[model samples]
Target chain A: MLPFARVTVIGLGLIGSSITRAVRQYMPSVRITGHDADPQVRETAVRLQLCDDVADTPGAAVIDADLVILCVPVGAMGQVAGEIADDLPADAVLSDVGSSKETVLAAVREAAPHALFVPAHPVAGTENSGPEAGFATLFQHRWCIVTAPEGTDPLAAERVCEFWRRLGAMVETMEPAHHDRVLAVTSHLPHLIAYTIVGTASDLEEVTASEVIKYSAGGFRDFTRIAASDPTMWRDVFLSNREAVLDMLQRFTEDLTSLQRAIRWGKGDELFDLFTRTRAVRRSIIDQGQDDARPDFGRAHD
Target chain B: MLPFARVTVIGLGLIGSSITRAVRQYMPSVRITGHDADPQVRETAVRLQLCDDVADTPGAAVIDADLVILCVPVGAMGQVAGEIADDLPADAVLSDVGSSKETVLAAVREAAPHALFVPAHPVAGTENSGPEAGFATLFQHRWCIVTAPEGTDPLAAERVCEFWRRLGAMVETMEPAHHDRVLAVTSHLPHLIAYTIVGTASDLEEVTASEVIKYSAGGFRDFTRIAASDPTMWRDVFLSNREAVLDMLQRFTEDLTSLQRAIRWGKGDELFDLFTRTRAVRRSIIDQGQDDARPDFGRAHD
Candidate 1:
């Protein structure tokens, strides 16, 4: 059982629902109450049996709860935190599953001044979203980055780290700024590139546009998966983590321009050199126990 | 049976081997012979029983062949066509599986003027590119875009169309320019972006680079698979399809700039608007029977 014996989970989206399932899977005896702004999601949580008690209100959910995890969108985090601030236990450790940490921690400080806020971003998810998308193994071997602001109690970060550890993830602690920068390269830029390419394909004439989607598996298909992730949630992530994402985007654009110049100038050697070197990283990724070497066609997802 | 009774497949790589396999599976009595530039691939063709008569040379393969299929690299098409131009029977139909049509068609025409040449691009492949990598089901349900010049014989184009149709592909005739434009959006640009991102991740310091790979399931992993495709082939593709790729890259840059601007300004509504719109195309792709929904967690391709 976790040190925090009683926990309140706000929102029953993919992250929230997964946490509810993980808690039940690993610590069944501990009580978990869930709060969602939408009643349909709340009712669905009850139906899925993800939570022991699906509180009709966030206030009811966190009443007397020892810990609270806000699983709302990054943009909505401040508002949700504010709504439950008075209800949160004075000594409770409050955290979030938001992708961006600085903004989340900022909001937590304002909404729940009495509680110990240790901001976290679980670097785990798929293009799929919503409550139904939750899975027990979603975070298996994935990263859970915790960005504790200055003056945050050490015990509070430890308690929050322990929460993610119990849920089957490796935890890392860094300043919120560093976490945002690292993940901007790791996740945000990839999604942005994918969205743009898909949009570019969409802008083609009706005949070829439909055909592009039809024959997307040639290479364009994988981009669509990342491009399909929840919009409002990602919108908030970019809006909140703007600086880092834009910086990385600039680097990517410049690099891509250089490549375009090489291709346009018939520099086959330059193009081949980059293409060859890139393959080594792929081999390294496979050696690191990520990615499989199987043919993409017969693979189920392709 | 194909409209042409005897088929000669020159350059037995993945596409050629797959074509040989698919033909043998569906048309058992059809006469099929294979020839590859490399002796190793030719030997593998014999060991795998991929063809009934493995020809000793390109000339031997095309001799009396009713249909001649060039499966070599796009740059090698002219030489292969020249090597066997005299061997091709007058009524024989010649075709190629090159990624670029205008270049291949022009090259093949220069080599063999009288023989019917229908240029094609099979929109199916894996990162692995060798005789051993070929499988019978590779072309099943994949698109095969054929670009025959305006003056090319209709009977010749239809014969090539019938051949691929027997292999379970939906074949379409397109202008070489249009084929380049559409594929520039669908295949080339996506590959260039993936290669760039994987290369960037590889340039990181040892520790974070290792973690970037380890937890690549977040997004970076997919790029790695594409980055692993044969170096020489992709290099040649970019060099040959330069202009169209550059044009598409320009549009993509503009779109990325808009997105970068939105992120810089913390425009939540704009981010939400674009990201939300991108997801619908993925849905349409799935509905079109192009992409599958279940995210492909990297496959094991040896």
Candidate 2:
């Protein structure tokens, strides 16, 4: 059974377009309506046939959608929700693919107070953005964190969970605040660190940017992939999840400072111990099917 | 013409085994000798037929070889060089695959002053180690930094560069100190940051280790791939490249601090600018063929 028969994907970016493609691949009979703030993206979505209908605005997109998903940046979630609120079906389940949950939840709830909102974040993406950069299989075997606030309609939440499952995601439920904290440690901090290191490497007077690019296989290349992610989306994520990201950043800084001290003091044992422990974490990630067991994250082959 | 008629690889770990495999694939007529400190690894090397013969000791491995490459931890480079010093052929070019170049050059010169030495670090590897983890094309399209000190035999250095070329590497020559500084920013700092972040994620008191592993696809998993690298090798790298790594780390920390403050103050513009600039680095890396342009480093398909 299809959880959502008429789905509206607002903001036809990577996540939105991916959901459109996934829905088409998994449930061919379901109707998909896509809308993007950028006319260029909407044109691309139409050319790609990512949705059955490419709406010119949010209101047109959600007027008849049984499931409305806002895939815009978190900072813009409230405005988008407000734009579609009057046209949204009373029975529609409103969700989003924002990385941060708390701010998004508050914005969505305030804007669409009468709508059945079941916020979700599919923890899956490539560094690329826009409608053309998405694929149907991007979420296969990945996690879809469903952050439905307390007192949310049970059936609405269940339908949202069912929707992600059909799209090939493993669903998990968590409170909005808890989701922000968890994602802050697992995603936001990593992206921030990657961006900083890439910036640091590029700004060095001794190392030319070309040299950094040439020798990136040593390890820097991996960080560059994440750091290359959409700037506006990440900026919104950091700002929306400020408290949690800052808290995690504090811990990471402390840990990095200790490592810095160890390097200065020539503490090989301390370095070895931490490195060894981290290897075990990678093993667990692979064991849980969160990543491939192939070495170098399977990047060496290419 | 082949650079050398005979080759010896000591310490049959990832780098060593990869050299053996690459040589066998690219230069079929070149006789290859392999040795490792671990008896079990030597047995595995022989079983895998990674070389023409598996030597039980470093001296035996280099006895008749015209090119001998040391593939061990930086901290062990001196000891390994000394062990093979008595048996090194006079005409043989002694080189190493150590991540740090300056200290390695000193160690090789002190131990085998009569023999020609050309230090090389093939900026290539997977997280996997030992004989079974190697493949002939591991160094293909990868940069191999060749560092030959002042007054070194130019002919010997040329031969080493030729050897790497035949094995499918792009070779670049630079001073040992200069190589260390460039790598400190490009490679060493990246590894150190990845290790630090992975350690931080695992040690978090509020986020369960299982949760971190489960949601790793968000970005933490990329860091884990490099963090899962051989601990002893990385330990030796940090200890040997202390000054350069420490310097780069300080810059990275300061950049991170500035970003943290931006986030704290909700300065989204600052975050967006840095993120946007970093994207260009990734683009340059892809254009140079240093990394796959495929999204998610081409891990999405798997």
Identify the leading candidate in terms of lDDT.
2
Model 2, residue B18: displacement in angstroms? 0.8
Off by over 4 Å in 2: A300-302, B300-302
Please list, in the order the candidates appear, how each scores on TM-score for chain B only: 0.94, 0.98
Over B143-212, each residue of candidate 2 has an lDDT whose tens digit, in order, gives 9999988997888989999999998899999999999999998889999988988988888787899889
Question: Which residue ranges in model 1 land beyond 4 Å of their true spot?
Answer: A1-4, A150-155, A205-207, B204-207, B295-302
Model 2 CAPRI rating? high
Quote the B-chain TM-score, candidate 2: 0.98
**lDDT tens digits, residue span A1-302, model 1:** 47678889998888899888888887777799998999899888888888889998888899878889999999899998888888888888888888888878787778767777888888777777878888776776777988988888998899889888888888889888887778777887788888888888887663366878866867998788889989988888888888878878777777888898898888888888898888888778667655665667236421
lDDT of 1 by residue, B1-302 (tens): 36778999998888899899989987778899999989999899999999989988899999888899999877788989999999898888899888777777778989988778888888888877788988877777788998989998888888888888888788888999888877888888899999988777666553277667755766777777788887777887787788888888898888888878877777778878888888998888778766654554333212
Model 1 chain A scores worst on lDDT over the 10 consecutive residues at A293-302
* TM-score of candidate 2 against the unseen true structure: 0.99
RMSD of each: 2.7, 1.1
For model 2, state the Cα shift of residue B238 in Å.
0.4
Deviation of model 1 at B123, angstroms: 1.2
